[model samples]
Target: MEGQLDHHPTPLGNWLEDLFAKLFYQPDDEICKKAMKEEMSPQLKVCINGQHVPREGFDQVITEARRTYNISVQNSRELLASPDATDKGIGSVAHIQTFTLEDKKTGNQRKQTSLTISVIAFSDGGKQLIELVEIVLDH
Candidate 1:
């Protein structure tokens, strides 16, 4: 089941994770936000802990994140195990990542905020972007 992550490496998941890991180590907020913009679907929706955010979108999330912290993502990795079938078609990928975040001003921080993201991909031509859910599974 967990081996499933390797299956989607060609479609962009690995690249995205690597980008996040790099952003986590960098100090530039704008660059991190730019990278996120490249990864997001135009109309993104995220479901975290059962609370649904409709059309909350990637831009909004980035804006909010920037407002809250210096915004760094660390220790990003993917977890894939036993994917189940889904109706929208790109199938489903189960992946988890851990990152440490620090406050912008105080430099206060927390370690090991693990997240499990469920992604669905859609294509126009040969390009793909994640079109579905992302969430936090570890606190």
Candidate 2:
């Protein structure tokens, strides 16, 4: 039952949830850096709003988010999970995230969106590390 879904933090599902909480909701740079270093594969691919973002472009996305949104994320809830049939180790989850953003000179704005996050867990030195992340914007 090593890969069983009955576990409290079903390997792939739990890790993906935590990753999104840190990257999108909390916005912790150090944690994000560490997660990327330790969890993600070197050939990671990320897509947002239907556009593919090469691994190297991740920093730019982070920078843009910081500049445009100064956001505080709240009410993050995992809505659904879809496990991959072809790969038992892969899973995807739909999450509802709520957040508020403020521009010091402008005003405050609140928004909520559903995001689908997909993760692939693969063995690296006997430890399962997340090798792929495919994030989809759910409108």
Candidate 3:
């Protein structure tokens, strides 16, 4: 029971753009996950620092993210506005997201916590899946 990005028959470009803003950049993992499954193609792939991670489905990405940080995902989400233009698909989105990681064992909050601006790429679909995400770290 899926619908096109232009389910209302508006416009792909504008509809897709706004859909991404709510899903990928939202402050809720549940919301993002739901949108990812709907928008992203089965052939989704991701690259980090020029290193490609093969067959990285949406679910795996979230699982790996939690493991890599060494802290439980407390409340981490993004708020994106719009993106520029790109060759592949939609350009990278400009967003501001907040993340708080808590120690897994002791449940202690990390000292280093801040909000940041990030760029996110989206796929062309009704759901608008995030193809790539790059965050500008704050010192």
Give the alpha carbon lDDT tens digit for every residue of 1-139 in model 3.
Answer: 4652322212334445455444433456676566656665556555544455554543575555454444322333333434243334444333333444454566655533333322334445333444544332322
| Per-residue lDDT of model 1, residues 37-108, tens digit only | 565565656665667765444456656656665645555555552242222334444555666556777888
- Candidate 3, position 80, lDDT: 41
Model 3, clash count?
A: 2
Per-model C-alpha lDDT, please? 0.52, 0.57, 0.44
Clashing pairs in 3: 5-126, 25-78
User: Clash pairs of candidate 1?
Assistant: 1-81, 1-82, 2-80, 2-81, 24-73, 79-96
Candidate number that wins on lDDT, 1 or 2 = 2
Candidate with top TM-score is 2
TM-score, prediction 3: 0.42
Model 2 vs. true fold: TM:
0.62
- Models 1 onward score TM values of 0.60, 0.62, 0.42
Which candidate should be chosen as best, given lDDT against the real structure? 2
| Residue 74 alpha-carbon offset, candidate 2, angstroms | 2.6
Regions of model 1 farther than 4 Å from truth? 1-11, 19-26, 29-37, 71-74, 81-91, 120-128, 137-139
Per residue, candidate 2 scores C-alpha lDDT tens digits across 3-115 of 53442334456667676655655656778666656666556667777777776686566556666666666666555566551346455555556666666457766564546
User: Can you tell me which runs of candidate 2 are displaced by over 4 Å?
Assistant: 1-11, 83-90, 104-107, 123-139
Collision pairs in model 2:
none
